[model samples]
Target: MRTRGFTRCGVIFGLSVVIVRLIGGSTGLVCYTAVESLDLGCLLRWDCLHASPNITYTVQTKTQGDPWQDVPWCVWISSRSCDVSHVFSDFELYNMIRLGVHLSPSSTVWIKPHKFDYSDFTFSPPSVSVSLKNDSISVKVQFPCATNRRCSHDACCPISKLIDPWTTVTVYNERNRSDNQSRTVWTQEVVSTVEFSGLSPGQNYCAVANFSFPTFSIAASPKSAPGCVETGSRWGMLPMYCVGLALSLLFLVLFLAGFLRKPRRDRTTADNPPKPLATVQDADSSAPPIFVDPCDIHVELVDDHSSIDSFHGFHKAPTSGAETKRSSQPTHFDHSRGVTVQHEVQDMTFESYN
Candidate 1:
């Protein structure tokens, strides 16, 4: 009886070691959170033997009523963890989906579905950055798509290939909190950046981005906590405050410059007030001003004249000795009233009339 019991113990220990060797390694799951609220994303980790014949891992997922389905196109997983840098980038995964680990028929484990209440900010926080462009909010968020999976159906090795993770973005008025949702955008594309225009400048806005996360293996969310970035294009209060500050500084500078400049008193000739100008200058650049000797006194006044003509305007001289000169006083006439006002002239001189 003692010999038989020893034989059975040795057999059992050998079988256990054989099973561990066939499985390649052990896998553990942990999920946690940085905030007291529900966790956001999770991390999956395992030991990897970097050998010629690398160990392969396959993951499966299932919803409430759905049957067990393999994650898409993922033939063999080489990484030790499921993260942004791992196979998940190729295979989209999300939260609320149950995960199944399949290495071989002998080693398989199922994880419970991760339930996250994202409607409440306290429970599920968003990872996003907001900026103000011009009365608009430009939000940039690299939202992780569904778990990166490559579960292709091979004749030799069959797997599933279907990844669709819906991403939702929301821009809300901070005053309204989560109650008043101003705008919401939804897409499945991997592009992580979007813009929200037609926003009221100088208002408070909050941008939040939320998407499903495929979590397994981890009992807690990773240390990289999701964050929210508050910003606007041009209407946010912060931008408006900056603009107003700039304008105020400009006004202050102008005021200071005006105050520092000296003021001059109005001046008028006391002995001889400056004489008023008569003829306005024309645009002719060739005609130069003719200087008058101020001492010369002359006036050729006519009572009945054909019309007012240019003063001291010259005509072609008929005789060599006699210069053809036309002289007349500055005169203005009112034909309706038959009144003519003539100014007494001291002297006037010019070269040409054209």
Candidate 2:
């Protein structure tokens, strides 16, 4: 028999699905008043009937004869509502899509008091003037290829090597129009290093760069440019290497401190203790040797001479004065009935002979 378990991928996929369902609902919507402003482009809206297969939409211009004249560009239809992709995002604004719709420069622009009627519905401010200009402008912009090298303060990592060697620079210039869209001017390719010239000089340009990242969304995003202000090259593996080196040094130090220190081995035991040997001192180098008389007339051999107990294991030899005194001491014997005394100098062995 075999058992099955969920893998990491399966768990991640399940969680992602749950999160999408929770946050990806269309129940969030709010209604508000509609007012037109300077940001004017062709406006169109439709309430998607739940049963309809697609949304039928139309264009209502707030400007004309402008650099960007109004004409039907694209039509999007979704089950819920067609998200006017550049025109109106899925956000609720009093006037979600405002083109420079106030009034055209050539005409006396005023808000139409009456709500104009449409085919299927009624809309307001059906007509307005084209208040815009068309002219060529130029500006100087620093252009650098995103290379794999370090970036300097003034130089940008060349965008080419940063994302793709052949990656192009896309610049979006939205002209005077209703919606912030209709302003996509150019997505030109930059193939040079120093600086790019002949850019739309005076107008505001919104530019984004692309680079490579490990994340899927980040890699797929067009704004992958890491700032050139701080770092020149990516510190990919240097930090990890430094951390590993530090840990290794720390472990080595700990091991040495724990095991390599000197132990207290200089000790002794009772069986083999150190002994101070007796020192041989010179008697008196200046004194001459004096010989005493052999017989002082009263020489007597004492019996039961157990009093001289100095011959057992004495390390020092007895002096002459000590021997004389020991010889003069009286001796008492308990063997009174029969006691015999014998004297010998060389082989003197003492024994009680009865």
Candidate 3:
């Protein structure tokens, strides 16, 4: 019975040792580093080889010759990251800062502290946008510090006040990826707007930018996500020109047609003058019309007093039956005093007397 009990105890101890080794080897802190963000200020990040449901983490920080202090917002948190930007409120950018990590329920084990200065923080990549002009490409870069609330409130924020800042821009043609151009420009503004000319029209171009601040000892940020734009075609104005030309030609043709038609109309009017319209008579008028016979009528004028008196005193004698019958018919004649006289009978013609 004693031997059996010893064997059971040995086996249990061996199993316990094996379980402890597996947990310790598989679950341990991997890496820790400081990140400087444009929007969030400074942050501390860490990673574990394997995440355990039961393990919680604590982060602590200390400056030179200062006692270790637990991050107020990061104590006993399961998250592997925390914001320590507030720790830099004192504007001690040159001071040496150290971070320590503690795992709960395993208080005996502690990770080594990581030491760094505020200036050593890595910068996050900036945002970028691209636009196309007639034959050029324009790129605009926006840094994170421009929109950070903390930087706005704190005038001493290093990121907000950059020194000797510049951007490296690279332009790539989408059709030929190997065909690219690069330029570096120094800018003092929060947002950098740049124009790149001498590019092929009707081609798709992409731009990427990385920000650098040599004064702060911060390395260049990671390249921003690519922004793309297509330039205007070289013949983009062809349609407009064609439309304008067509309109001009149409106007010229209309003018010529009007000019030619006017001359033709004038020639026709000159060649064939319009005949005078016959005078129209109103048949409904109440006035009577005078009738005159111009062909069968004859007139005689008398200027001698003897002829005028003889005409007044003359009386025709009685004629034979046939002559009376002919004389009975009406005769159209005129007699004037002191004027010449002429008469005509049915069987005899009388000459005019002066």
* TM-score result, candidate 2: 0.16
Return the TM-score for each candidate structure: 0.27, 0.16, 0.43
Which of the two candidates, 1 or 3, achieves a greater TM-score against the reference?
3
lDDT of each: 0.40, 0.28, 0.59
TM-score of 3: 0.43
lDDT of 1 at 335: 42
Candidate 1 all-Cα RMSD: 21.7
Give residue 165's lDDT in candidate 1 (0 to 100).
28
1-354: candidate 2 lDDT, tens digit per residue: 000111221222221110111123355322111222111111222222232243232232221222322224532213221212233211112222211111123322111211111111111111111111222222212233321223333554433222222222333454522312112112133332212223343444333333222122222223323211111122544687899999999999999887655342333354467897444334343345544343422335544444334433122443333322232333332233233333332322322222
Segments in model 2 whose C-alpha atoms lie over 4 Å from true places: 1-111, 114-247, 262-354
Best-matching candidate per TM-score:
3
Who is ahead in TM-score, 1 or 2? 1
Cα lDDT, model 3, residue 227: 95
